[model samples]
Target: MLAYIGKRLMQSVITLLVIITIVFLLLRLLPEEGYLGAAAEKMTPEQQEVYLTNLGLRDPILVQLGNFYSNLAQGDLGKSITYRTDVPVVEIIADKILYSLFFGLGAVVLALLIGVPLGILMAQMKGRWLDRLGTGYIVFVVAVPAMVYYLLIQVYVTDFFRLPMLFDEDRPISWILPLISLALGPIASYAMWMRRYMVDELNKDYIQLARAKGVRERTLMFRHVMRNAFIPMAQYLPATILFTITGSIYIESLYSIPGMGGLLVDAIQRQDNAVVQGLVLIFSSLGIIGLFLGDIVMSLVDPRIKLGRGESVR
Candidate 1:
């Protein structure tokens, strides 16, 4: 297990390095001769060179990449170019991560709260009204893109109900609607997968044995069935978290929330290479961390499946 974990950690490091390299290369490839495309038209060549140099855009791409790696090795993420201050990149991300978390975490929790029970209900009530209702709900949500629902609720539906707008509220729970919309796809997916898994588990001889032994239906489902059946889905949580973060782009934009996803859009609009690169690195790191977390969690859940790096249980 220890060896497996060590191997996975090395792989994570390698993956992160590759991600940074790709993003650095992309920024270098952007068509700009030292901020030449900026909105400022009065800049002299020397001034432009200084500004770009300061942003490390003037260095050879390879040299700049090496420097970036060096700084990162020293735990220094470069400052924002557009923001034009000494604020640490990580600090900036930390400050705004809460909003994304508010939505992302809420969505995940909601999906689990709704999805797992639905799965169990569908399995136990297979071929009955309950199963049909569960299937219908999943199908309807899956058929409609989340963006459509977000708009529908924010526009026509909410207006009709005369409910306070999410963004208009003082509390972040006002974000609940958008968060639900963001989570809808994953919730739909979970229902489909978990229901099938639960059905399979229920059909197993072990389940029949338990039922024959007079176990309560609820205990049989939750204590034995759901726990074992949901293991595969547990492996999926990290990726789902990443998807939620990326999906936040549209949701945040629609809601006018000032989170990283919306900030990414602003960076692109301004051709702010540093902002774009910084965000890419930040999000990529988050993704890598999520992957690591998933692996560790899975290893913990099933010790037979040890980490790649052979590290002891975290």
Candidate 2:
């Protein structure tokens, strides 16, 4: 198991390195306009060369790349170019990430809590009214775009409930509506997938055997069916939890939340290469780590899932 984990860790590192290389090259290859912020554009050619030299942009490409990696190793993500001169990228993210993470995690956890039980109930009551209602909800949430629902919530739900539409750090309650809105689609997805997996489990030969052996219906559903059905769902838990840090651009924008989600967009529009590159690297690393953790979690959930072997242990 340790060997398998070590192998996966190596692969993840390689993958992250590749992603960094690609992003770095792409950012560098962009038009020089990317680096020419308002202050930079005003400089004479000599002053510009000095400025670029100070930024180490005057160095050879390989040298710059080496410096970037060296600085990154020392926990320096570089200074923001257009956003705020000399402000560390990490500092900017630290201030805004918590709100987005808190809201995002609230949404994800709430979705799982409600979606799983409802899905089980729906599957157990297949072809009944409850099943229809649950299925209808999944379809509705999936069919409608998130932005449409976000707008409707911002208008109708907030107005009717007299809740704050905008996020206010002083009042924690202000986060509720955005959390619900962000969770809508994920809730539906979890419900549909959980229902599908549970239903599939219900039809298995083992389930039939348990029934034939006079096992109680409740025990059969909860113990055997649920356990097996949940293995696949568990794989997503790590990714879902980790991705909360990335935030939702649409949700944050609608609620006027200052979060990391909108930072990338603003950076790109302003051609802040450092901020853009840093954000991309952060997001990509999180995604890669999430995938790695998911695989490990999946292996733990089912002993049959050998990490580096093909055949199951039985």
Candidate 2 lDDT, tens digit per residue, 173-227? 8988988887887778778888999999998999999899999999998888999
Off by over 4 Å in 1: 33-39, 83-88, 166-173, 210-219, 303-314
Scored by Cα lDDT, where does model 1 land?
0.76
TM-score for each model: 0.86, 0.93
In angstroms, the error of model 1 at 91 is 4.1
Candidate 1: give its CA RMSD in angstroms.
3.4
Q: Model 2 Cα displacement at 286 (Å)?
A: 1.6
The residue pairs found clashing in candidate 2 are: none
Positional deviation of residue 175's Cα in model 2 after best superposition, in angstroms: 0.6
Error of 1 at 294 (Å): 2.2
Residue 32, model 2, lDDT: 68
lDDT of 1 by residue, 1-314 (tens): 66766777898889988987988787778767534554347888678777777777777878998998888788777666554445677776666667787788778888888887788788888999989998998888878776677788788766776655655437655665677778787777788889998888888999899889999988998898888878767777887887677668888888877788887887676566666777887788778877777777776676666454335433
